[model samples]
Target: MILRTEIATILKAPPIGETVTVMGWVRAWRGNRFMVLNDGSSAETLQVVVDGEQFDEETIRGIGFHAAVSVTGELVESQGAGQAVEVIAKELTILGKTDLSTYPLQPKRQTMEFLRENGQFRMRTNTFSSVFRLRHAVAFAINKYFNDRGFYYLHTPIITGNDAEGAGEMFRVTTFEPDSAPRDEAGAVDYGQDFFGKGTHLTVSGQLQAEIGALALGKVYTFGPTFRAENSNTSRHLAEFWMIEPEIAFADIDNDMDLAEDFCKYLITYCLENYLSDLEYLDARIVEAEKNLPKDKRRPMGLLEMLRFVVEDDFARITYTEAIDLIMRSKPYKKGRFEFPVSWGVDLQAEHERWLVEKHFKKPVIVRDYPKDIKAFYMRLNDDDKTVAAMDVLFPYIGEVIGGSQREEREDVLRQRMQEMGVHEEELAWYLQLRTFGGAPHAGFGLGFERMVQFITGMGNIRDVIPFPRAPRLADF
Candidate 1:
């Protein structure tokens, strides 16, 4: 088989007289005769120009957008206005045709809502092609960041026995009807008939599983899907989201913070280097019309440089108590009550995070040493007793992209902490076993992947960046 390379690769090469084959989807028609075709190769649309002699409009009529085609012709170099050179086709074959009327991905612009409805077809469009391609680059960079650091990638169970965070943040599952389930003599429903022995739910965090592995393997990380039952209808919150968690044994609070910052910088840099061209193509063609959207509205910068800046600079850290003091001193809103009230001990709200990152610090800020009452019980208690060694990395556009902590490693301390925190002792004996054993001190962090995509792409709504975003009241794809 005489194989042919992509049309874009041969654009500036020696194709003047040699006949070569190029396969791609018809992206558009320019002038009265020439047509552009793509192979879904990269973020770019490879151009194939046609001269009316052997490749007349009547020769290939009514071949609508996204129609698959093959052009066998000489690759020539020229100073044509529309496309660089041209494909003076020896033969043009329309392999697959689409109806122009309802193809959904025409040359004209479509709304994000409209494109979302055609998510399956939207990838064929230039916009989603770039978004998803960049998404792939970032994900690869995320894993490579940890793997290069001698960290083992641990596959945590999706069906969890216990929720990592004691916030009742899990989606309960059952084979039987939920409402009419059988009960025990004590009126509490017996869960033997449930899916996973006692009861099971989608995991809210992989921190616990990562903990088990980290204690044994010494250093570990988990990149997997997580679920939260919280009825959040905001752009930043998702019922099902991807989380990246790295756990290390014998690591202190400071060590965990260092890892968190380095990991972020590594991911950003990796994507920027590998996917800068793809992003530019995606931005120019597919999303050019949609730049008016808040997320796409930001001044464009090279993805590679942005990533380098993230890793190259020192990230600022401020304690939750200090952050609250700053907010109080500045007084974000001059008068009225806050929608999500805040104080020294309160959990930081999205608005509060936005204010701190967007207005106050104006950089990637890690708000650390959170109030214990508002954080997970697994966090190490600070010397002051009121706060814990927990941190949340907040950025300008995306509020809280990461949450981390130095875990409670002491057996007696952990047991007492669990009980005092009102977490069920019976449901967590397995987790407690790690503490009972060699259990050296360990710490880890969980980064919301979708939120990171939203941050990187500057896409306002989380839905657009994800392939098929799963959020409350919006599961359409």
Candidate 2:
């Protein structure tokens, strides 16, 4: 009978002199005597001392890189330098053997692009293993932070009729064949005969549906997958991604900003307190990766230092107009180094946003009160009539981690905004009815879950943080 003890548990508190059984894939087989094993329980691996004389020639030959095996061994203090304890194998069984010649992954360092191609075995690598472990930690921290703050987790529909962002870049959900679909008298595709009886898509944002929950339950959040059909092949864009939207009733823009700051700090703080070892591994990985880069191209701060600074320091708050002013006066803008033009009504590009957070403020920033023309219709109209009560939380590496605003609670104002923006009022009758009936002043924001993970793990590409990435021309298991 084999009752295998996890490598993480045995490593945490070594049961010296006790004979135990451990099962895992061999990480390394150094000198054919030291077998390092890991079972995905933690980032750390346990070393198994396998005496070639004790094991049969076949068993010793099977122990190679990433070979699955079971070993019953006596735990003892290590004679090596890295780890504190080691296991002296009494019995060894080869469960699965790997042929290194055909294996895609090698013991030596591999490029991230190659690792992404071989995602089936990427998590076995230390870099990806640490990245995914922290991804899980950040996700767990998201729920804990919301649940502890009395926010209800609302599961919004993945397929929805409304375009919350009015971007019109959504993946259509339909069963009809593209060439042969029902047509109306005017020769247009008739969506009325579709499965849902109307056109629907994978939702781009869940904030609108979550608003209903907030109006009824006080504070609610939606943490689920959303999709966009845009053809953006950038490090920041994703075809399918997760979002965290928290809506609160009776809250203004100021209250929303305060919640955003506190909630972000809480998540970072939780990961720092609980998953420090994994973070340290990732931090060292970044340092090694950036060693060949020029001084100007390298990151200003290390991964752990940047995370701690974000949590400890206060995020600078300013209006959209103020941010524009700062960018216009920046050295990059004056020297014609900025790629995109900066102005009042124009939306802030990544370059402009990076300058504000990295050069001007030197910290995270919360820029509020964007122009009404560039923002969504749901944002409340400011008293000035030119801007809306919208806000975006910008971070050091990532430009915007969170974007939210005070929603338009007034029925007439919402109607006017919708009309001006060309949003059909008939489709959103239920949404309007909420305001007409019992809607109160409410505000909310959405944080891209992968972007947060990328920031924490210091992974260069957003696709690296997600397990199975969905992007333009790239969809693999």
The candidate maximizing TM-score is 2
Cα error, residue 253 of model 2, in Å, equals 0.7
Lowest summed lDDT window (length 10), candidate 1: 299-308
Give all candidates' CA lDDT scores. 0.77, 0.92
TM-score of each: 0.90, 0.98
Which residue pairs in candidate 2 collide?
Answer: none
* Deviation from native of the Cα of residue 326 in model 2, angstroms: 1.1
Point to the candidate with the largest lDDT.
Answer: 2
User: 1-477, model 1: which lDDT tens digit per residue?
Assistant: 847678557753645767888888887887656777777666655556676766556657756778888888877765566556677777778788898777667788788788878788888877677778778877888777888888899999898778788778678877768688878899887888676778888888888888988988899998998988877887667788899999999998889888888778777766666667665664454345555668645533433334444566677899988888877766655454347766777787877787776667766789899988888889988888788999988766457878899998877777878888998878888888888878788899988888787666656678788887777776764
lDDT of 1 at 131: 76
Per-residue lDDT of candidate 2, residues 1-477 (tens digit): 658999888977889999989999888877778988888888898899998788877878867788889999899999989999989999988899888899998878999899989999999888888888889998999999889989999999999999999999999999899999989999998999999999999999999999999999999999999999989988888899999999999999999999999999998998899888889999999899899999988887899999997998899999999999998988899999999998889999977888888888888999999999999999999999999999999988778899999999999999999999999999999999989999799999999999999999998899899999999998876
